[model samples]
Target: MRNTFDFTPLFRSGIGFDRMLNALEAASRVETVDNWPPYDIAKKGEDDYRITMAVAGFSQDELDITQEHNMLMVSGQKPAEDNAEYLHHGIAERAFRRRFELADHVKVVNASLVNGLLTIDLKREIPEEMKPRRIEIGSVKAKPKAEAKQIEADNQAA
Candidate 1:
């Protein structure tokens, strides 16, 4: 006997086929899928995040960070000097582009470059009404004096 798997049921489910089509479209639209610059994403706090990219040999003026729609784009370009002579060229100063997907409420906080690493911070502002709050319990109606006394005696015994 041979084991078999069925994919028809999965495709028939709601949005399953659309999800597959979207994945295919994304794969087809990738411009530089193989060119990946090293980066790190860290959680600064509950609603804050930081994205750090290793962008050595790139000046502050050569880097650009922009937010368009729901995408965060970071690109760097270093032009080669015409008069420079190199016996052996090992360093990579070529242009590169990096992108990140931003959530609906995510916003760029600040960006800075230190020691060859470019760090971009983001913060998601939660509305005051959306934040969790502690609710105060109001006092209950006055109980009968005899019933209250009986409850106190029961608590003392327990």
Candidate 2:
């Protein structure tokens, strides 16, 4: 059974959160989970993250990684295999594509393939202006009386 939610009311009231709501709706959908070429995501530091995938049979040329907006896609395509007779085929040699959703300001730093693992490093860089800062609050000064008197004298002269 799949649990579905009604976001109509939220949409009617909320603003500037369409992307998050869309992601939530997409996640709520019932879809088949792909287990092949399993991967792991880990947080290395406060602003650093890593993704590791077990791609045992894939080569550097056969794998691809791309980031578009907030989406990260990784795909692997195996070359053609020669025809051979096999009694029992247990190994999985197939093409696979995986995607990950990245948060705003998160960017891919580096990627490396070692042995059978594909590792990708990521970091979140918040712009200086977007970061929080203490606002200076000083006493509000009253309007100068000289300027008010000058305005009144000018009006009388006019």
C-alpha root-mean-square deviation, each candidate: 13.1, 5.2
Highest lDDT against the true fold, candidate: 2
For 15-120, candidate 1 gives per-residue lDDT tens digits of 6375554545555554646454689999989989999998888889999999996689999987767787899998778788898877666999899999889999
Q: For candidate 2, which ten residues in a row score worst on lDDT? A: 149-158
List of clashing residue pairs for candidate 1: none
Model 1 residue 10 distance off true place after TM-score fit, in angstroms: 11
TM-score of 2: 0.86
**Per-model C-alpha lDDT, please?**
0.81, 0.92
lDDT of 2: 0.92
Q: Best TM-score goes to which candidate? A: 2
Give the per-residue Cα lDDT of candidate 1 at 78.
Answer: 78
The residue-level lDDT of candidate 2 at 43 comes to 98
lDDT score of residue 111 within candidate 1: 99
Each prediction's TM-score against the native?
0.61, 0.86
